[model samples]
Target: MASNMGIQIGNAWFQRKINLRPQHRGVHLVTEEILRQVPELLQFSVGLCHIQILHTSASLALNESWDPDVRDDMEMMLNKIIPEDMPYRHSCEGPDDMPAHVKACFLGSSLSIPITDGKLALGTWQGVWLCEHRNNAGSRRRGFILIAKMASPRNQSRRPFTVCIEGNIGSGKTTFLNNFKQFNNTMVLQEPVELWRNVEGMNLLDLMYKDPGRYACLFQSYVQLTMLQLHTMKSPLPYKIMERSVYSARCFIENMKRTNVLKEVEATVLEKWYDWCINHALIETDLIVYLRTTPDIVYKRMRARARQEENLVSLEYLEQVHQIHEDWLYHRTLFDVPAPVIILDADQSMEEMFVQFEKCKTRIFERCRQSERESRLLTSPVSSPKIGAASE
Candidate 1:
């Protein structure tokens, strides 16, 4: 079943979600929307862009852009072909709802485009279209997950590559780091929870979880300070694997502020500090590997692990934290993220997690190895030979 297809390949990958507001039943140009969202696309000299709309009721398409009639014709054709009036088993939602799903299946929810000279290799007449199939009752927010692969620059091969681990509590971040530790030339820096707990043997982490209002400000200050320290710490090895980063601190603090755990004055002060630290370049990250799992799953794992700080933690608190992370990480317009994210579904067992590691290991090492080589070349400094000097 193998076809003799030969082509040059790229090793680096980037992925993120692009959000969009609701639109009426029609085809709308979304190429510019995507371009504006993912500025990283400009970094690639040559690559491929794959966009998958993560919903079943809408779809993606590529067609004429200059003519307005094309969109109207597309809608007209779809409506005619899959008439909403047709009787169906799943019509309890609405007349349009069932037809929307049918049209989505026919049109497809994914699109692929080539990248040339850091631009989508689209034709003059062709452009990406978001075909919203639903009739407007209120609003329908939609999103497309974009994954791009590009050739890594040779110069970056020698820089210190850093990877930040992100996940809900009890989503196996520590365990993942432990397994990652076995790799040579890797520096694994764990979360500062232990330090937060043992500061003067008072256990600020436990106090904050048990009684947030009493110790919210104080705990947040120590958490930010320690996380900033971890962020600024230099890694001698090529692979700098960190358990958590300043971004996690932002999510937790934002949750406290949102839930009224931190008062107005306290929220303002702590958020100002966070903005200052981030603006001053306190940390840098090459990539973020998100250990994605549901809040319910994490709660189960947390209860099973029975960590002291987590012993008194309620399911409600865990749900808030999960929502905060979803907002901060995916909804970047609300709160910007420093690096690109790769979401690994962590709902599976430990053995499956290792398999996931193998999948990502190649790209992780590519980034790290590039840095090591670049460092050696820059530091070793070789002189060029003069013309005809060897003969002389």
Candidate 2:
């Protein structure tokens, strides 16, 4: 058999809002100065780096770097073209602010540079130019957010990176999602517990557990509706971490039928709803993290923290629920999980579990970026091999 063609994969996207040291009022060659500071860029094969100046006064652009006079001449021409004396209306912050805006308009406040084989894909003579429009006679302040994403060939549209956190009840799903909330490029969509509890002031979970046969169908329906909402939620950022999904609801109701808590009729109705909704859901998860724990551990945690809704939860019920999760997620006895599943040993101390959470968290983000880079490599336009200095 022919060997599968290998692709370079690693971290693919990184965004950091950093301040470059202030420079005197002039143009400067900051390609090396800025790149050396970003180690994440060194991991990918080919991508694009975006530098955006947050401040209106400063600007970023690509220009001649081989000759020192080129930058000096450019700065001189900028002063001549947008002369400070020309403007008078918005001079509140002295003469600099208004003229600064004008100079910035020509130079621009953002630039995107292509990366080839982990280095800036630019002409031998090209370099990154940071133009300081304000008169920073002494004080130089940094003001820019540099974002680099693996660029696909001709822009093959890719969905946002997504993850579904899977675990039995009280397995620290919420806490795990909270850990990733610090990422500016990541969004967390939690389970709609509040909506389920106060549906017309009727505690669905509490009522369902008290009378499983009576409320099983109603509970499953609400779960299916809410999980669908989570599945179809628009991610505000490039990365989304969903607490639970429609598949879990399906498994839960399936177990309810197996144990006779939900009759065959109720289970059939719930399964049909789940199958249609899950198959029709627009967004699919790229990865699933299964927080695996024994029923005893889960039950201990559940009862000790006695939420009124879960008061009816018993060790016998927990065992069956745990088995259902294993059968669906690991054994594949039920529906097939579409994404890769990573089983985490969740029966550890809180401190130890958190440490594991960080490891899992890091791996998920790293893999997502690597996948993006690989996709870009496949469709990217053919180009001559890059040579010479690092940024060239």
Taking all chains together, each candidate's TM-score versus the true structure is 0.54, 0.57
Model 1 CA deviation exceeding 4 Å by range: 1-159, 331-333, 370-392
Off by over 4 Å in 2: 1-158, 381-392
Q: Model 2 reaches what TM-score against the true structure? A: 0.57
Best by TM-score: 2
* Model 1 lDDT tens row, 275-308: 8998896488889888887889989999998888
lDDT of 1 at 66: 88
RMSD in order of candidates: 19.4, 18.4
TM-score of decoy 1: 0.54
| lDDT top scorer | 1
lDDT against true structure, model 2: 0.76
Tell me the tens digit of each residue's lDDT in model 2 across 185-290. Answer: 6656677665566454366778888998898899889888867766664433567788888878777887887888887777778878877876676858899999
